[model samples]
Target chain A: MKYGIVVFPSKTLQDLANSYRKRYDPHYALIPPHLTLQEAFETDIDADKLTNIISEIAKKYEPFQLEVHKVSSFQPINNTIYFKVKMNDVLQNLHEDFQQQLPCEESKHPFVPHVTIAQKLSNDEHSDVYGSLRMLGVEHSEVVDRFHLVYQLENGSWTVYETFRLGKD
Target chain B: MKYGIVVFPSKTLQDLANSYRKRYDPHYALIPPHLTLQEAFETDIDADKLTNIISEIAKKYEPFQLEVHKVSSFQPINNTIYFKVKMNDVLQNLHEDFQQQLPCEESKHPFVPHVTIAQKLSNDEHSDVYGSLRMLGVEHSEVVDRFHLVYQLENGSWTVYETFRLGKD
Candidate 1:
């Protein structure tokens, strides 16, 4: 199975992202609004082992605030738009810690904590959306209490395999 | 054994880092100046297995240019100074691919590709050096042809276990 790890945004943020995503993204219905921590990799790791690894790391991190700062694009490189995450030591540490626990390959992309908005657009479509999203550089903060481990089903949609809570709360 | 993956800077860059590192860092004499891709992790995997994994991944990447742009610090979090890497898709992809191949735990810090100038400084010392380094930023670019897998000896110093070249070059 192919698996990835992510922290879904809060309800309010999810609703906000959903609005923009539904209009702009083709995969909006395929997955919820999320900031990917680790890109997907092929793994046969059992659920129990996955649960234990995530659970152990979860205990070390208390729920923290995540601020979505602005919209950015991978322009000239790829046709993807994302929400720029405010880089914080706590968040960086959380990513690093979880990465250590998982029994799969780590992503090579420099960890840019972001919720991808739209991808696979025509060049014209990307330019159009990029302009529209510039006005969407709003600041939204949320208390991140949990992260999910998800896997791609045969239908090409992703489903949550497990949820790891932050801290003891 | 404990292992790490890194790309050693070119000869000229190595000398440049070595000069600054020797004066500021205590570990300069202990290890060469190199950019770490993976921090040391304990593993029982044999060298042949490690080589095979790395070799397979290397074939997917063609040699690319890497630019070491400026100086940055982990101050207020940790006492370390590094050359801020210019984030690019190729380098990011390389890191993500190599990470997936290794059998070990990942680090708890976001991967910032840098040549360390100094570490283990007191807070005040870190402040002084950070100020000095801001004006000392120098841009250097080099073609990245290969990366090395190294292991720490019983004496706490690291040695190369294997070298994996990118593409056929």
Candidate 2:
């Protein structure tokens, strides 16, 4: 199965991301707005064993605050625009933890925690959107208590396989 | 740290169990009523890695129906009185999955999924309580959507480290 792990932002954040996504993101229909923790990867491991491992990893961390402070873009790299989530020790550690623990290969791109609002744009369009969104900016914060282990469906949409809560008890 | 995996029944079931626990189980205050999936075991693995593994395992199974039909006792073996949970393929498979995947010794007893209501009774007390509870019987069913990975605190109470939802999406 093809699986990935992610943190879905709150409805308020989702509404904000969706506002931009509806106009700019091609993948707006494929997934809810989320912060990708692990890029999608194929794995042959049975689901039972896989979830057990994830449950163990989730037990270590407490709920942490997630903050999105501004609109940003991966301009020269790919023209992907996003809500740049502020990186803290908890988020950084979680990203690194998945990288080290999951069977998938290390991500080709460096971890930049973000909620992509627009992607696959031409340079001009990217510049137009990025400039306006950057000025309008964004400021949102919420506590993230859990993350989902999700799988792709035949229809090309993502669905949650399970949600693992964060923290020891 | 010492950790275990278990399913906490719904409030209805918990209250039922607690009523009996208050009088019969000596370890009642130590933990809530639960159906154990994995026994407590000590592990040196970091929390991140452990939760990841657990999360992966949880994603495999859909929520399954749990039914406790009668009160029973582990007679000649011991004085552990419990509500006998009917075993189905889903529960059996989950138990086997943990045994095969988790880093723990094989359980000394065979898997007979149950929610303990009493234990550590004397021969006479065992007979008295077992006779009364078994006659009272129990008939309850609930859909279990999640299971918890829990850790023992310094004071010895069990606390949830994380809760992993069952099923795809």
Candidate 3:
């Protein structure tokens, strides 16, 4: 889409994912360690469009901070996955922002933000993947300063398209 | 060349040199707000050769934990620019682990690792480049994990050749 927000990891995230993978990717077939803020879609986009959107959204949002919690996973519904992110008010607010502005209204499942490490496979892939992630071990909560705009390409791979400062109007 | 890590956020790194062009294309830039561990290399690579190296290397590494810290930058020399990673003991250990087996040697730049956000412009592009980055307001000091083996393609783009687990070994 022309514009949207994405939540993935910083390069340092690879470190956290690797630690988690050492333990999880081997034993658990965790979805690769990435949590998307929302699915990408084609839309009319650009800085002017973004600036207008941000200004419109900010009018109602004063600004707030949230804490990213410890590692957790999704159950048998999909593949097991591990993620690190702010799960409280900050996340809820961002979600609320999307629902008001985007198509998140169509998601079949509730959004649970995560940064992916391993992905798509049977139980067989876990032993190696999880073991690798485990070696990386657990990481502490990190701060989130901005919201990202990412695009999922034709090949089913996701790439960040752009970013926006959340509290700044 | 056969075995190398290109670092994460390489997706839009092409934007580094094209800094003066336009902000519309984050495609040439690394994913916004990510940290890199090392200045990854583009080595002699082919899928078969790279995969073989990975399959062999994967078996050797075991996962480990690291303490990630604040944002820093590096100017090895006046003209050279880099995002600097803090040196923690655990990180040092991981560096040694990687150095022993990988085809490329660890950077002599004291491993002040970082997933780069932008390229330091040549003296020629300096003024215009900094002006652009200031408007972008990129953030740094990211946590790291899962070292990826990426392929820098002929079209001046990067594709993840393979991602390797470090601690799971």
Which candidate tops lDDT?
2
- The stretch of ten residues in a row with the least summed lDDT in candidate 2 chain A is A153-162
Q: Which parts of model 1 are misplaced by more than 4 Å?
A: A1-169
Model 2, B47: alpha-carbon shift in Å?
Answer: 26
User: Per-residue lDDT tens digits of candidate 1, residues A36-145?
Assistant: 87777776776547767777877888888898879998888788888888888767887787677676667566688888888888999999998889775768988777
Better of 1 and 2 by TM-score: 2
TM-score versus the correct structure, for each prediction: 0.49, 0.53, 0.42
Candidate 2's error at B98, in angstroms? 30
Docking class of 1: incorrect
lDDT of 1: 0.74
What is the Å distance of residue B72 in model 1 from its true position?
Answer: 0.8
RMSD of candidate 3 to the truth, in angstroms, is: 18.0
- Tell how far residue B45 is off in model 2, in angstroms: 38
Just chain B of model 1: what TM-score? 0.93
lDDT of 1 by residue, B1-169 (tens): 6777788766567667766786788866445678887777778887558867877887788888879878898777788888877777667776787667687665577777888987899988888988898788879998877777766544344444455667842
